[model samples]
Target: MKKSLPAIAPGLPLGLLLGLSTAAPRAFAQEAAAPALEAAASLNAGDTAWMLTSTMLVILMVIPGLALFYGGLVRSKNMLSVLAQVFTIFALITVLWAIYGFSLTFGGTGLFYGGFDKLFLAGITPDTLSATLGTIPEYVFVAFQSTFAAITVALIVGAFAERMKFSAVMIFSVLWFTLSYIPMAHMVWGGGLLAEDGALDFAGGTVVHINAAVAGLVGAIMVGKRIGFGKEAMPPHSLTLTMVGASLLWVGWFGFNAGSAGAANGIAGLAFINTILATGAATVAWLVAEGLHKGKASMLGAASGAVAGLVTITPAAGLVGPMGSIAMGVIAGPLCLWGVSGLKRLLKADDVCDVFGIHGVGGILGAILTGVFCAASLGGVEPEGFSMAAQVWVQCKSVLITVVWCAVASFLCFKVADLLVGLRVSEEDERRGLDIAVHGERAYVS
Candidate 1:
């Protein structure tokens, strides 16, 4: 080495030689780190695209899907009121979610609530990534979750439709969304107490369906029954519109369930097929039950059954096999029928659209059965050290916590609305129907 260095390094110091020897390895390491840095920052185009589509589909569920579904179920006198309530709630919640809702939901590590670290979505740019979702941009995740929040508030409107004051509805929605919806979402999906305790909710069995149902039940009781609820026939004015809305809900629910998987991978595919199978099975089961009970299957029964099946399979969409989904659907149809009829009479609450019956009952059934079917022995993608009994107990605990939280918070929210603006319209306004009475517009001018 000394002989070779004689030409150019004749006067080179020993220190300079040592420095040069170490520089080469350092340069190599710097070069090697460049690829890893790039990889860590890179976004998957396919996943980003899928998530964007999923966000749009969920929005569809709130607007025309849920709006029409609830609208058609109410009397013609309150049709426009239902439509207006659903549409306005969607818009209002979307704005709130962008402001502080997202932060309090997914920002902190708290057991009950997240921090305000992401208020106004601070510091999150297009380049930002979701730590939980990993492959998609953080913006996509925020948008997707906002839709769930909006629909949850909208779902409560059906329970108090045709009677609640417009101003009261607005005030109650804001309060309940802040107090109940946000915290429950954190507990189940945002890695809070239930999540840490291993409660399985693949898509929103606890957070969306049960949470909204409990709120709906509370509202139904607090708002009082519609005028002539049991005395008069309050049949649906337009079954055709309901069917269309149900169809849209069915289509959009694919995004709700499969998109929970967060990627266009095998799990998403599994969820998609399960949704179709379970929904179809539930529809048939409901038809059979209705025919046996009433000697005829109405279109309304079919639509209700389909929704029951959809809600039942939502929590287990990605966790269980197709056959398991079918079983859940079959059970949900009959159970929810009883929920709307017998259970409705038992509770003595006039849930206009049966939100508590289908969504509440179906969600509870699906959540508990998910624990049973999620075992590897039952053809599910089991978690590590999976035990059906332990998981079912965990599911029950989560459900109980959610029901209690929602019922209490909803009661407070309704009381707040009643204090500030009054919970129900006057007798004259209610008798005249909410459409022309509240909004000064008619759904159909006769």
Candidate 2:
């Protein structure tokens, strides 16, 4: 009678009205949450595109880029062998990554090793989004990380190049990739120990460069020297090809650095610019150092410097400022020069392509400097409550961990390979060169 009861509630009892009143807000909340849920599961097309491009670029870095670079540095007789090794390693690692490698790296919640929950890439689909990346499809992330693993294993080939048996190299690569690379990658990048400890390897200072370098060093020592290593002259067969490969590496490295951002955003832009500046600065610095030390600035020195700069900036690619990257580059050139020369001789290990020198020395230096340059005062995008000293200490500890882990694991891997297939070819085979001895191919027909 008061108002004949309003429209829809005309016959509803008091309790029913009360219940409906309460349910209204709950229904509204459910509706509101639906969009958010959809968004959370959605992929950013731009990010996916960039990551796809980045994966391709990194593949370029391995195949022709690293292959040619390493091939040019070896003697003419061994050129085809170097290319074969790099190419084969790339193929091998890519397949392995799709199998257990990806699962053992990014699938678990362990402190040292990721579990096998994702073995065979199970439970993943085109629609699956990365929990960490949030927006990109998990498949893209997997492909991107696979490139990193491939290149890392390929890098070790340069250390024992021209001497190691093909079968031995393959065995060592499989073992080291499973044991050394996977663990280090988990610790640094896959939310394991070092990452938990606030280690600042923005783009794989410890995970990729240092990890590969240490393994390469160990392989060099265990594989022993090439037959005529110390007493002979082993000039690069084609500096021109080396230069071309270096150039390609420089171009592809943008993917290596900026792609780590996982998005086509400001951080990616920062990393791209830093890659250019640091590499350019490092090249000049290397030329100057070479001119001072050897009385000549060589194309080889320039190429080496560029690589050094690239390696040094990798750990700090998005963390440091432009000027800070240049400083890192400048420091990297000379330090890596010494690493290849003084450090190489001191160790008495014949590292054919200076894998330890440029990648190792530069990675350590970049990782340490990343701590310093990451200060907001130094134009870096500082971490929350950042302390340069604390970060630097964390960086040093990470480096120490990587070095020890890689050394021991690499040694064991080499031993296993040696026991299984022998680490070296016969002296006569080595003298004849790996191209003809192992692969039965020639780089040049003439």
- The CA root-mean-square deviation of candidate 2, after full C-alpha superposition on the true structure, stands at 12.1
Write down the lDDT of every candidate, Cα atoms only: 0.83, 0.83
Candidate 1's C-alpha runs over 4 A off are 1-41
How many residue pairs clash in each candidate at the backbone level?
A: 0, 0
Candidate 2 residue lDDT tens string, 1-446: 11111121222211111111111222332343344445545677887898899889898899899999999999999999999999999999989999999998889868789999999999999898875465678899899989999999999999999999999988998999999999998877665777667777767788899999999999998988988777978899999999999999998898998887667776677889999999999999989998999999999999999999999999888778899999999999899999999999999998999999999999999988988997878887675556678878888998999999999999999999999999999999988888998888888998
RMSD of each: 13.0, 12.1
- Would you list the clashing residue pairs of candidate 2? none
lDDT of 1 by residue, 118-218 (tens): 99999899899865455678898899889989998998888888899989999999999999999998877665777667777888888999999999999
Candidate 2 lDDT (Cα, 0 to 1): 0.83
